[model samples]
Target chain A: MARAKKPKLAVWKFASCDGCQLSLLDCEDELLAVAANVDIAHFPEATRAVIAGPYDLSLVEGSITTPDDAERIHKIRRRSKRLITIGACATAGGIQALRNFARIDDYINYVYARPEYIDTLAKSTPIHDHVWVDFELRGCPIDRFQLVEVINAFLNERRPNIPRYSQCVECKRSGAVCVMVSRGTLCLGPVTQAGCGNLCPPLGRGCYGCFGPMEAPNTMSLAGWFREKDTSADAVRDLFRTFNAGAAPFRKESEAHEQR
Target chain B: MKPAGSTDPLPAIIDKGGLQVLIDALIGGGFTVIAPRLTDGVIALDTITSVDHLPAGATDEQEAGYYRVHDGGGGRLFDYATTPQGWKRYLYPPEERLWQAKREGAGFAIVEERAPVPRYAFLGVRACDLRAIGILDAVFDHGRSAEPRYVARRDQALIIGVNCTRAGSTCFCTSMGTGPAVGTGADLVLTEFGDDAAPALLVEARSPAGRKVFARLGGRQAAAEDIEAADAAVAKAATMVTRHMATDAAAILKRNLEHREWAKVAQRCLGCANCTLVCPTCFCGSVEDTTDLTGATAARWRRWDSCFTSDFSYIHGGSIRRSGASRYRQWMTHKLSHWWQQFGSSGCVGCGRCITWCPVGIDITEQVRRIKDSEGGPH
Candidate 1:
């Protein structure tokens, strides 16, 4: 009888809160069950145990901020059969990418007491910028349930059933009254992806792009609405330039509004 | 029975005393009933026992930047315009224990706790709140693969919606095309007509499950007079609202992204995250793990987090939004502008919780208008 080979799984981190990687550990009950099916090859955050890769699945978290990290991702790409970027940092440049719009040296000096000891890059970039990623899980800290679905989909050799639509669909499905229409409140549900469920709005708040931009987000139209509502252009521009600041749509929008 | 129309039928009158019997009936039917009670001078949702716990004859006075209690209302128990709390708390808790873990021998052992699906009856849910729940259903249930936790709670839950008899000063659900009246998305919708008049509840069945529950309620079939009263109540509430936003506001917001009015609003804003927390649809969150003293056992938790926090946008060694201005801008734009691009609808539900709870009282409508009126170019 022939024995089935166990799939190798690896987890990597870059520039982020470690919340996204914790989503895996957050899968406490599911973790062991997942490990049972695959070989726990490399995960520095969860366990010290390390295994050489040629990994069947690689879950990379955070973004590349330094030259070393940029090069390291390329090496990871070569060794993994399928590379998946998890969280806002790995897919977009993350909130840290906000520095991409400003001077890096100034920011470094502002935070670090010993700026000389810090070796950094001009910009923080997503994994896709450095290497190919088979799948990208959106969210600041990716939804664990959704994360599990992605893993299961990959394991089953099928496309993940992640929604590419905006948060508005979720708002509609939730049957929430449009805050902008009823309260004249600004909200991001229409442009944000539907991963966090309809959390902010139900709480009487608007959606923030922690999950990053949705597919082909129509930011211009939404911004126009904000303008009529009295939201300033600088305010709209600044909104797109946060967390997922380096994302294409948000980045382009912010650049269009750049003062200098 | 008369055909169901856009109005409530049967002038469904429920005495203030009957509330306990209704609640008891729901509980006896193996349903967990959640209702609003006075908490910190504000109406908040909590599990209830009887009619005594309901805020009877109480009404709230809501303003553009304030919310307060007002005296002298009918004998009706649920007379408030809207509450700060929504239905998401029971369905999607702020902090949930995803699972627990421990080290076993040389290897580690993990245990997954599948959330117990409870049969819930959400009582006193407002029209806007019902709409919010429907939006959540799309995200949690409509997809090809359902979210196990969300699906479990939603599938077994029953909704009892309440129509707005009075509008809040900040309410603009009419502009959003969501509320003032309960249009759809409810197992039953109740509207309080007036003090002189009996409390009328218009019950409509949206699903087979709802129909079953409706049949069990044993209420008399609604008549035209009952529905007429209900219609009058909704119309009165719609007219009571003082705030309004343009329908084409989303498109205008998109075009004005480069407008210069943001700096002024940013000046007064503090990125404290109160707005996100009070929001009905804001879903951004973070995860944490707590280990025993021995570090041998650990339990991971997922908690509510806000983007307004410095740590929320942290990257590499620092944060992306180093200034309050940028963070505030990010939050508003995502909520109103980019939301349409990503989700095909606006993110906000117009509950007005953020404005009332903002501590500093930042009115979103005013902020948007200022930006729109500003002459300076994009930042």
Candidate 2:
């Protein structure tokens, strides 16, 4: 098999805190190894020297909030052979998608003094909601280890070894006694996917669903459990409306409780 | 415990001073003594250097979904039953690199890597966990897929069980028929007796290794009353286990396969796998293999997996257990029914870790009771 000179990797950003991009940088030990084997094509966060791509692998971060971003992602989708969306922003609609619950005009008028100047879409949407994605990495700030795994999988033409189970798996492996049980704290590790290793549970706080819902999550059952913990209907609704609330599973669970 | 036909070693009285002598002797003999200690807000099994480091007067209050460690205001070692983590974590790690590969000429060369075994002396190991360690030994060491790492750890480690005087709110060890007393797994059994203000321990050797260690400690010979107090302590603990689940789970669940109550229980299930993860006997794991960016280096990793996930039962077409109801049924059925058929014993040791650690407070005992009350239940 004839291989093209080292695979060209491009990183793109849209509407996000750049926390996901920072995770790629945070891979200090593996960065030198990656730099020698792969070409850093079009990463604004890492370099201003942009090597225009017909890239082999592209990592897209952040949600599509603005109309310009919505159009720009389609172009990126066309340029890259395999595009993987990283973090909650690029996979789900992200925390900013809280605006999806209300009218965009109402949000702009309330937050910005000059509402007329704001140019944005009605809903903060994910890349898959617009264009096709080869893979999606789910996390508020994607796990660095998973980022490495995704890159490795792309190079080898294989599926990324990512877990579709809940955060409880990692918590248990770490020998973390359940905070919900040991401290009476409400945690979302039960329904949330396993990606973020340093979740709030082991740190004396409950999981706030930082990672999106696990594959085929049973939100209804989890909600019932929450209700049994004496959590108010309003509180449960508010929780589901937080990060990744625009995702269908979480959205449905939140909307079901809106009646109360 | 001592083998059959072996002479029973004389029981001895280990006062507060004698207990310290035992700890020092174990450490001096190149063994790390792990005991229950208060750290942060939880009582975890931690390596202890001194008797003061132990959770002497500290005991935890356990409920369906709540646990809180509180100080008992006096030094009374072995007064508390702590940690459901068991001895599994040290032996069977949560995540471990199984093998590493590097490019050699054209083909990759893989080399297996095993962690060096650490000799440990487990202190204050309750009877329930002693039973759990035995169950794990049967699963990993004697199974078709033998794990040498787990067996190595088991062989190197020393068990010192403490008899339980009281049971946790979630405990049902009596129903599981594995607790209230340490029988055959421990090397040495320690029973803290006498008044709380002035406490003493009765130390009995169950193995030759324990007898040698006990000979070093300056404990006096135990009297007949000392033995009676120890037996009475175990009896009281058996009575304290109010939560009951019929052990005939295989019989009850097999008849109730089509029951509607499964859906009712599923309504409160999260499919989080928290129950399985925290369970002492739930051993299901998946292996992962990947190469680095250069394709020159590769590593194989093993991580603990849970059956609650959709991917756990995946086949060529799709996941067999798609709905939450199906996943919950499969897990409960496997633990209670299939395990007995396969291992000649129930998977559950009834330590109550699964119930207490579950995020939503779903009680296993309650589910078992509901099934037994159904039409399919045995009369």
Tens-digit lDDT string for candidate 1 (B1-379): 2345633333344555445556777888899898888754567687887877777767786664456765555566677867765787678777788888888867778989876677889988887788777767765675675667778888888887788887877777887788877757777666766454346456555555555555555555656777677778879988987676656567667777655566655555544455776667676666666543233566777666666655677679987876666777778888777877766677777777677655346787777766655634552
User: Which sections of candidate 1 miss by over 4 Å?
Assistant: A1-260, B1-14, B17-19, B142-146, B375-379
* Chain B TM-score of every predicted model: 0.90, 0.95
lDDT of 2 by residue, A1-260 (tens): 22467889999998998999889999999887677767899999999998987998899999999989989999999999999999888888899999888898999999999998999999999999999998999888888989988887877777788888888777888877777777767677788888887567778888888788887677887777778779888888887877788888898889888863
* Cα TM-score of candidate 2: 0.95
lDDT comparing candidate 1 with the true structure: 0.72
Q: Estimate each model's TM-score.
A: 0.57, 0.95
Give the per-residue lDDT digits (tens) of candidate 2, residues B275-329. Answer: 8877888888888887887677789888888888888888899999898888888
Q: Give DockQ for candidates 1 onward, in order.
A: 0.02, 0.63
